[model samples]
Target: MLFRQLFDPETSTYTYLVADEGNGEAALIDPVLARVDRDRRLIEELGLTLEYAIETHLHADHVTGGGKLRELTGCQTVIPEKAPATCADRVLQDGEVLQIGEIPVRAIATWGHTDSHMAYLVNRDRVLTGDSLLIRGCGRTDFQSGDAGTLYDSISQRLFALPDETLVYPGHDYRGYTVSTIGEEKRFNPRLARRDRSDFIELMANLNLPHPQRIAEALPANAQCGCLSETP
Candidate 1:
């Protein structure tokens, strides 16, 4: 297996590249539009054929590179079945497995930050949590049809059930931490650690965080797979 974790300083987004070294086929998860060229260059340098550009949800912070990557590499664009984004080539349901060469990436419906958010479980060892679960704090549940209680349940029952050693890679990390394990988050996460559903809900409800800076431009653009000119 070949893997690389790329970061975007502008949005604090993390883009992942994973491939099967044997077959030289790969997938890009949650790619940022601004970094598409860099990502493409890396993929080319690594001698991998880009097969899929997958989104965890319709992000409100940054436009996606799925459309551009598809145009550049002919990779299919994939998103959660329930997401408002209708431009995806494939809409994946929970538990559906997407094969990138020999790797099996399972889509896990872990809605919390948004109504249809998903996390990808790669080879059953690492989980790519898209805003649903973060390092110490989770995503703010204040907009885009967010529900605090639902998010609490998703993390506690779904994500926390993974093996204690399962690696956690989050969508964005503002605090500079790169990765954590399920066990570490379960024991130390300030928001969910030892907190009951009610407690978790209460914590999210009062965050009072401001809306994403790019929401106005990002939402519409993301809905169309990063076509900024398309109307929402």
Candidate 2:
């Protein structure tokens, strides 16, 4: 397997590229629109064919590059089945696995940050947690139909049940941390680690976070799979 993690500074978003080296087929997770070209170039340089562009959820911070990548590479665009965005090529249900070359990417429903949030478990070893679980903190539960209690359960019951050695790759990180293990987060995450459901809920409820600056523009654009206009 081949892997690369790419970051977008403006949104603090992380895009991941995973490929099956034997078949030269690849998939991209949570791609940002502004970095589509760079991502495309890297995919090409790696001599791999793009098979899927997967979104963990509809984002409020930055526009997605899924549609653009699909247009450019004929890659299929995938999103959670419950997400409002209906433009994706595939809408996956919880536990559904999509094959990217030899790799199996399983969609795990982890809704909380948004009504349809999902986390992908890749090849049984690594999980790409889209905003559901961050480095030391979890995603804000103040907007886009977020629920703090549900998020707490999603992490504690579902995600934390994975193997302790499983690697966690989050959708966004503002603190410059790259990766962490399930055991590390389960023991050390300030928000959820070792805390009861009520405690986690209380923490999220009192966060008083500001609304995402790009929500107004990003939501609409993302709903259409990042095609803001037909002029392009």
Candidate 3:
């Protein structure tokens, strides 16, 4: 399997391109519109055919390039089953697996950041954890379907339970820390280190950080797989 992880510093978001080298087929996870050209160029350079573009959730930050990629490469666009999108070619369920060439992509339902959030587990070793888990902290459960208890379960039971060596790549991060092992986060993340759930919730709720300014525009756009203004 061949994988390319691309990061956007402005949004602190990471986009991934995973492929089966032998078959030259690939999938893009959580892509950003601003970097679409670069992503496509990479695919072309690698001689990989874009097979699918998967969204972890309806983004509240930057618009996704899933639609543009599909228009350019004719790849399938996939999102969670309950998503209110018209462009979701494949409404994936929990544990649904698809073949990107030969590598199996497993979709894990992780609804906290949003009601329909999902984390993609690639080949059982790497997880595209959207907004569920970050390198040194967990995503704030203050907007949308953000729930403290549910976020706890998503992290403790669903994600943290993975192997210690499983690589965790989150949707967004403010700090420079790019990635971490599941075990590393379990032992070190300041937010997850707290044993008291109430404290964690309180801390998250009290933070006054402003909501993503582009949310109003991004959600609908993301729902349409990046073409909110266009008719499919």
Candidate 4:
């Protein structure tokens, strides 16, 4: 498998590129709208064909590039089953796999940051956790149908259950950290480590995080797969 992690400095968002080295078939996960051209060019330079642009959920931070990617590459736009993106070309349910060449990307339902969200486990090794789990912290559960209790369950019961060796690639990171192992997070994450469900819930409730700057514009555009009624 071939994998590359790209970052959007403005939003602290991370977009991932995954491909089969042998087949040169590729997919981009959690693509940000402003970085579509860069991602498209990189895929071209890598001698790969874009097959899918996948979204973990309807984002509130930045607009997605999925709609524009489809226009640019004729790739399908994929979203988690319960996401409100009716414009998506494909909707994946929990445990369903999207095959990119010889690689298998399995969607794990981890809904808390949003009512519908997924973490993609690529090649059974690394997991791209989109806004569900971050480095040493988890996503804020205060909006977009977010619930602290539900988020706690999803993290403890779904994500933390993965093998300790699994690599975690989060959707966004503000602290400049690139990657972490599930084991490391299990042992060190301030939000989850040794914290019971109730404690976790209370902590999340008191985070007092300010809403994303782009929420008003992002949510509506994201609902249409980030089209803004037309590909930008």
* Residue 99 error, candidate 3, Å: 1.5
- For model 1, the stretches where C-alpha displacement exceeds 4 angstroms are 230-232
lDDT of 3: 0.86
Model 3 root-mean-square deviation: 2.0
| Residue 109 miss distance in model 1 (angstroms) | 0.4
> After superposition on all CA atoms, what RMSD does each candidate show versus the true structure?
1.4, 1.4, 2.0, 1.7
Task: Point out where model 4 deviates above 4 Å.
Answer: 229-232
Relative to the unseen true structure, what is the C-alpha lDDT of residue 62 in candidate 3, on a scale of 0 to 100?
A: 91
Model 3 residue 48 lDDT? 93
What 10-residue stretch in candidate 3 is worst by lDDT?
194-203
Instruction: Compose the digit string of candidate 2's lDDT tens values, residues 65-152.
Output: 9999999999999999789988999999999998878889899999899999899999899999999999988999999899999999
Q: Please, what is the whole-model Cα lDDT of each candidate in the order they appear?
A: 0.93, 0.93, 0.86, 0.93
Query: Which lDDT value does model 3 have at 147?
Result: 87
Model 4: per-residue lDDT, tens digit, 57-169? 99999999999999989999999988986899999999999999989999999988988999999999999999998999999989999988888888888888999999999
The sequence of per-residue lDDT tens digits that candidate 1 reaches over residues 143-193 is: 989999999989998999999999999999999999999999999999998
Q: Least lDDT summed over 10 consecutive residues: which range in candidate 4?
A: 223-232
